[model samples]
Target: MYFYNLLSKLKYIFTLVITTPYYGWIIFLQIISGFFSIAGIPMLIPVLEYIRTDISGAEKQGHMGFFNYVFSFIGVRPSFYSVLIVSSVLILLGQILVFVSTTIAQFAQIKLSGEYRKKLFNSYLAVDWLWLTRDKSGEMNHAIIREVELASVAHLNSQRIVIYLTQLMVFLALSIKLSFKVTMLAFVIYGFLIIINAKNTSYVQSLSENFNETFKRLSTLTANILQNKKFFKSSIAYKGFVSKVFHCIDQTMHTAKILNIREQLQISWTFLVTFTFLICLIMSHRILRVGFSELLVVLLVFQRLSPQFSSLFENYLALNKNIPIHQSITHRLNDIKKNKELCGDEIYQFNKSITFKEVGFRYPEGKRVINNINLEIKPCQTVAFVGTSGAGKSTILDLILCLLKPARGTIFYGEISHDRLDIFAFRKEVAYVSQ
Candidate 1:
């Protein structure tokens, strides 16, 4: 079950990535940047070896076999200064790549968020009036605004995950080249760390879900209160309404607090475990009897490796937390698509009269508003519907405007049925004034 869920989440993320503009370019930049970032690790060995030989007053020879071959191939003699300069160049190039990639990614994030918001807003406009009325305005607002923002964040995090994973793989490969046993041990430690944090990851996802729901509720409550401020202020139930708002705010804060605490715990636990592993590595150095320079290089590799591992794990957690937000936005978008208003292609034209033939209408879950009604008005004629509150006057207007379809019978414009007429063209002919 867990595997299936994971696969589904992955597929969703992939879909999001592919749909995003410039995603291919961004990924290409990230891959190249990852390679540049780790290209300096192996150079450390030769540079350190040269420094050691210089300090000991020993002859500096190209003892780094692989690096020597590489230097030769590049038409550069393996020397302390040469290797140092090349390593510095590689690191500088990596930083430049990082900067370029980050700039592009930030631009992409903004563009993606804007696109999603526009898409969602347009979908809301196109959806059936009944469904739109049934949906909470504040919830829709939150989805268009906050949820889309989180989706952008998720996209950025996924990109960072790619970069981190690449760096981690390179670090592991380099570490293995230096010391296979130590590299394997480090891999095992990382695996154990993942196992230890599995529960925390799940808990974080739950908190994320709760956090999203509470915030959405808070938004809805706030919007409702603001929209009906006059009624709430003039009525005796104002305190109750205010309390509900406060309760929603409190729930949102509480969920955020727990989520933050979990994040802190994850960071602290990773640090402690990795620090312990570092200390053990240091303490076992003498027992292992490895050469001083080689051991130093190995320690350097592990030093870099530890943070990459931690970052990769944290990225995974962040990605997991965002899954629910993505799912919520996606589900809402799908619902909007499903409820999209239906219309015919024929243009509506009124030549003589607007007529109703036994027209009837009702709320989806309420008593009939109008039934067995027949009426007509010629062109340029004015009609007034008089009724008490909850009467079908507004409903009748909506039906005449073709905003709401009748439950029974037919409405016509000079003998043409309402459903057969194009709603947009019909609406263009209407000039409505409403209270």
Candidate 2:
């Protein structure tokens, strides 16, 4: 109920209307679709109730205000015939809107997803080669696909918020006009339900994240093995690798099984809470001094609004479940962006000259790969460094190529310090062939 940080973070997603004109149309249509559908259901409920009560005619039914005006505008009074006609029309119109809206929104979702993927592709295109090699290509591919998918569904928040708010307002207005006391009592029960859900959210979110990560790892392991089927058939090492992968998968699946149980339990609790709330509302209305017809109408409206409220909670849970993965992907993307920025506008422009002035480097293990190494490659001259395996030959080349920065010294490309020079621009002039 009071997730300030989460709410703040989600604001951008909810503001789809203001964000872009294209998404605005998608949001507008989706909102209209859900509203008309939900409103039509509730609008017909009273008509069905009247019919069930053996009321032969709708003239005895006293209904005024918006629905009455709507019916009257079509030359139909508040009779059973008019109610039937109006409800049928509303239902038909609602269905048509739903179809059109879903089609348009789906098209927009696909378009936005394509755009998101293109942006990530462009990022890869613009980034330097060094950053690309730092991670396995498959991992980067996964990250790109996953992150862009996240961006693609960003409009879901907008759709939910708009639909829920509109439904809540319409239902609340109708309910209050019928009986304010009943509406207030329903809200109290809803508030309590929300509080209970809030208490369990943290645990639910943790379990969700754990389950997702385990599932992803399991998928990645399988994909990696399948992609290297030839190597697995030929190499002795592949057996050990496959065994390790299966072991990891087993452990992950075991955890996932437990998480699945917890998730089912959580879902059950949510339904239990909702059912309890509905029971309370029914009991309260039954005991109240309100007339049977009024009670029936109130209960019917509550039945509709309750689900809308439940939808809000469901969306909240979904958002909580996804936030961790979304954040992780966002973090990785930001790191990639930072790396791209750090690599300046230097494209490979190596005119056969590269220098390392007392270069030094330490790997992540704190072991020095190159220490105080000084080297020079003359312009257009054939030069080679040969040594036993594990010597600093490749390390020196890595430094000269500006792939790894020196810890103790500097590299120069044509008298320009590599760090100060536009690395993106300088890299364009360089060609690397590594064994």
Candidate 3:
């Protein structure tokens, strides 16, 4: 049962990620960049072969691709020097493609940042008054500002992950085409190394989650401490606040340290594995009499592949880190959508008295905030609710405003229950001041 539950949650997280906002054109650009990146791999093969012997003979005898033909048609001779320049320029162009694609993707993210914050704010405004008071506190403010920002970032980070994955696919395909046996051997070694470091990835993800939680708590604490600074002037209150703040910071630093250590360990492990693979390739080449050109190409692939895998791994971890923020904001938005305070179809025309009759209310903890309250107010007549703090004054006004539904009895505008009145129109005609 636990395994199935975990499986379901994993499915949901990935589904949420893929469904997040992404620019289709930017993704297409990255896809094109992937091909551009892969072109350099094949272009290197002949260049390496050309370097093994006489450059003129190697170039005159070697097969060249369409790019070589284009250079030739433009009056550039096909030779080792030409192939060398072509490969370097092609790689440079690929870098440009990646840069251009990332820039556009970032632009899309900047546009979405405002949109996501607006989405969260509008959702907050639409939430039932009772729900806000009932649910857990400290999550709302940070989620609205910080987590929503993180959510906007998820689209950009997710796009980067997709681009990395695309590049990996292209690199792997071309490396295999260039030298099947070497590619297969490298894949096994690197695949095994990745499996070994999979636990580290999970650990990093766990640490990221802890860091996110700590940061949110810190935000709440900072706000709370500043608002209640009077309490903190005393040594006892100051000590308590300092203790909590320090604990949160200490925990955050500890988690960050662990993540950093894991990253270092993973990088060190990748270096060791790649080095071992190179040695084994050399030994295998000596036995199989593999061509030097193949060795050089394989070495080139390994050099690029090592960093690719490392970055891809890091990006995968980023996906995990961003998932919670996305889910936090999205789940809140979705919950509001599901449990919204729906308005009635009735048009509100209030020119008479608003009355509350035998209304009772309690909080989620089952403590009554308002009990058996009765009040009435007429048009053009101002009234005040005067009570000590935490008395039912604000709750009563909220009840009158239709922000909170009564647990017992009714609130009426004229003869109609407030629920039947158009809430938007009613609120527009009414306003409240709070303590």
TM-score against native, each model: 0.92, 0.73, 0.84
lDDT of 2 at 314: 66
lDDT of 1 by residue, 349-435 (tens): 666788999999888997898998999978876678899997888888888877789999999878678888788777887777657
Score each candidate by Cα lDDT. Answer: 0.80, 0.64, 0.74
Position 76, candidate 1: lDDT: 88
In model 2, the runs with Cα more than 4 Å from the true position are 1-23, 26-62, 65-84, 91-121, 124-142, 145-158, 215-244, 266-286, 289-300, 341-352, 355-366, 370-376, 408-410, 420-422, 429-431
Model 3, which residues run further than 4 Å from truth? 1-17, 20-23, 37-40, 55-89, 134-138, 279-284, 369-375, 385-391
Clashing pairs in 1: none
lDDT, candidate 2, 1-435, per-residue tens: 468845764574455434433555655655575566445544554565576676555444554346777666767667666666666666577557645654665566567667656666777645544566665555556556664565445445445545565666667776786777777776787777777766565566687667556655655666677778888889897878878777767876776676557556656776777678668767776576666666677776777777777676665565556556555556666766876745644444556467778878887668787888777787878888889987888877767666677778888776677777776666566688768
Q: TM-score of the candidate numbered 3?
A: 0.84
Ranking by TM-score: 1, 3, 2
Report the number of clashing residue pairs per model: 0, 22, 0
lDDT of 1: 0.80
